[model samples]
Target: MALDKSIGVGMIFIASFVFLYYSIWVFILPFINESSFIQQFFLPRDYAIKLPLLLLLLSGLFVGIFVGKVLIKNQQKQKSKKKSQ
Candidate 1:
């Protein structure tokens, strides 16, 4: 529908903006003079790596926990079904 299409376009635009911002902050910012005004706009360069690494680690942990929970529930269901049979 029109609403869904508009939402998708908005999301895409936001994502593109974030990607461009982060890319500039990480890749291009480092090469620029540290004393320049642009440097003040971004966090310290170390965070460019640390933040993403932390996010990746946390997301992986969450995914592992989710898969474990689903597997445990599936196993429990199978055992109960077998017992009933």
Candidate 2:
């Protein structure tokens, strides 16, 4: 259905954005010199990396499952139409 496709697309978009943001926060931030914002946010660097990583993984999984469902539904619809004709 169109709605499924839209939901899938939206989930994928959000997942991608989160993944990119997480990547930047985890990998890129380490190299940047500590600044006011950086110090305030990543102060206890011990667990700061974990939160973004967790979010990235969860969103990635949701995207995969959602897109897979859309694909399967589309396939089923096509098969039914062929059978009906």
Best by lDDT: 1
Q: Which run of 10 residues does model 2 get worst, by summed lDDT?
A: 36-45
For residues 21-53, could you state the per-residue lDDT of candidate 2 as single tens digits?
666767888888786476555445666657768
* Local error of candidate 1 at residue 45 (angstroms): 0.4
Reference-based TM-score, model 2: 0.49
lDDT (Cα, 0-100) at 59 in candidate 1? 100
Candidate 2 clash pair list: none
TM-scores of the models, in the order given? 0.81, 0.49
